[model samples]
Target: MKKVKPKDIKGHIEYLADDRLLGRMPGTEGYKMAADYVIDKFKSMGIEPAGENGSYLQDVTIRKAVTGNDATFISRDSLGNKSELIHGKDFVIFPNAVEKQTTLEAPLVFAGFGISAPEIGYDDYAGIDATGKVVVVMRGAPDSFTSTVAASSMDIGNILQTAANHGAVGVVMAFTNPTAGVPNISRGVNSVLGPDGGIAVSRYYVSDDVKLFSFISGETLTNFLAKAGLDFNTSLTSLKNATPVSAPLNTTIRASYSSSHEDINSYNVIGKITGSDPLLKNEFVIHSAHLDHVGIGAPVNGDSIYNGAHDNASGVASLLEIARIYSRIDAKPKRTVLIAMVTGEEMGLLGSSYFAKYPTVPKQNIVANINTDMPTIIAPLLSVVALGAEHSTLDKPVANAASYLGLDVEEDPEPEQNRFVRSDQYSFVSQGIPALHIKYGNKTPDGKNNLNEQVQVWREKYYHKPQDSIDGTFDFDAGKTYVQLNFLIGYQVAQNPERPSWNPGDFFETAR
Candidate 1:
């Protein structure tokens, strides 16, 4: 088989990342154009379509819901006093936590960091009857978890979910960072349908005026408990001892106004090159990259189009290049090689989630998924930060492939960043499929300082903002080597001897 050429890969990337694509946001005309280009690339490259039957498009079902004016929110206190909280004025609210506009009049308990970690033998909601009342927890993790992070070992998000699971009617979490602020709520796209309609993600906040009650911070709640002379560690106990000092805690808030989401049709672009052996053909090697970006935003430097040239335009380029290489290889995989350019990734892995719900191929046969989202900008590639690196028996296959490219396979530098749980790969991982994700190290090309400083500079100034446009100074040279590493992964998985698996003691492994 001939080696993939860097020149050919760049040609496809140049066209896809061109200003014409308009950032390739899903459900938009520009997204349609990008989708069409992807299918066309497959046709031109002579890659066999492996979507459905013989089609190139694996159509995914999606439901969009916009908060209608009919959806109203209000609150009443113990004195039977009530106030109408205006919508979209005070803060943003999501119907996500619970279906109906939850009305909580029972005692409001301030639960300290509402975290529960069985592994650590701790439960924040322990011995608390918080069924109908709202528990005000603090933003971020508890002290125990923060200490673990400083020692390079921390995973508290899972513990945070305990509040919802433990029957807390509603949760009000406050921020501790006075300098930095919490992320504003963003609009959600419902990919999975529910008994009511669809399960929508959280909502973007509106300004003050719509809130049913006052919002309290963790610091303030903690202070209130401390002033009451109760043990702070015993959160519920403290709340129980401290008698109510106020008649009603009411705060006004509002939710952002957007068109109620309508069902938007979309598809996952898939192409495949089948293997030779019959038994091996049943197996698969999956290569994926998301094709969605933040659509239109307010405006940046007079340009509203966020031509996400670097965000994932770089990723799609890598995907297409791999497809072209696999298509032209003299010898194909022992199993099938799947090249997928998934959609709705910006919308909570919606496309991949939909694919999991309706797979074109058997989910059991998929060996592993390699999803590339953010690429290594001009920075050097030192190691492969495989997100679920420890879960699978496929680590050797990755190392074998990496060795072929003279690259090292390493665990993610920022697992705390939760890249494993952040991208399209998580959609498949949730279903027990082993996944590998590679990204760049946090260092500048010139090695002047850690890339985190610059990234912080960019995130504050550009991240997800209209300012995230590509500039001349960005280092893109890493793309070539990055693709080299991926090409090896694509080939090796296609020809690997054993299937990847979730390692022993992995939570997802037991789920499967």
Candidate 2:
């Protein structure tokens, strides 16, 4: 097998992160340039096109919804007193992706975390009858739940669907931190549109029935809860302790909003390497990385382009190197390998979700996905955290690969970040396919292993900013190691006869 070279990884990043790409934001000519670059590289490597119509491009239509100025939110108490809240100050409304205009007037029901997972013996909607009402929920799960499960529980899409399933007309997500401000939706919300021009997947706007989805400031929530004779802190404490505090609020909210949408075209670049075994070749192992980033933003330090060198340029580069390694090998793995550089990941994993839902190949034939995003290869590659791997038999391959590479495998040191469900891997996991994302762990050459601390400093400086250009901090050797580690893990799965399976009685297995 040919070894991955650090210089090659650097070369790929140098081009992808160049200022000419303009951060590779989807729907822009710069993004098309990046897609063309990937296609050209894949073609040169002899990788077969595995995208739509035998080409390397999968069409994705992204709909961006912006809330109109006519949006209004008014809270009326049972005593007939009304208080109209200011938009963008007290709260911010999420644009209705499906409907151009939406209006709703309903009573509010506080449903602790808005999670309905009975397998874990925790259901926030247990006793609450949220019929024809708006559910007010905090953003968190019970402390006892596993990291991945907790992240899934707090997912906005799941929360909205759960609310809709219970006959709720709307949802209001209250901030957990009293000092936290309402989310800034100035750039509008994004959703994937199906071939029929309907919503295929979205983090917001669950369905037509769920008309209103908004976020309230933590201070405003405290006042709202107070009107119902409930202390916000006490209710939050009870919910966090898994005690399930829910009730009908004394206040009813009336909200009206108009949404305007702009549709943009994007693409997911895909390449394939056929397997050697005839039967095993039917199944595939996916290697995915996002090729998009937050475009030009408010200038910082006199720079505007948000070149995502470490955010994902490095990740895409790693996948390129992995593809090259396969090209240099004489004998291929038993199962096919699909290298997917998806777009619209920065826009809420839109590209990956679309591909996962409507893959070029049969969805069931896909056994596992190994995703790479923001490896943060600034320090020596000493340890790794295989996010989402523990939920399935993919953990074995991760262990074997780590052992082969002499890298330690450790638990996520920053579980509070909710990283498992934050990236493209979650898109596959949501579709019932086993998947995992490789992330840097807290390990360093010096025994202190305080790499996480260093990463925090780096993140503050360059993460998602113009400073994230190719000139940013980088350890190319670490990038080379990451490529090898991820390639080995996927190679083992491709060689194995039995398809990778979810762990016995795992949450994902039973849930699916």
Clashes in model 2: which pairs? none
CA-only RMSD, every prediction = 6.4, 1.3
Each prediction's TM-score versus the true structure: 0.76, 0.98
> lDDT for each of the candidates?
0.59, 0.93
lDDT of 2 by residue, 143-190 (tens): 888899999889898899999999999999987887767989988999
The TM-score between candidate 2 and the true structure equals: 0.98
Model 1 C-alpha lDDT per residue in residues 315-360, reported as the tens digit of each score: 8888887777777777777888888888888866778766655568
Q: CA shift at 441, candidate 2, in angstroms? A: 1.5
Deviation of model 2 at 65, angstroms = 0.6
Question: What value of lDDT does candidate 1 attain over all alpha carbons?
Answer: 0.59
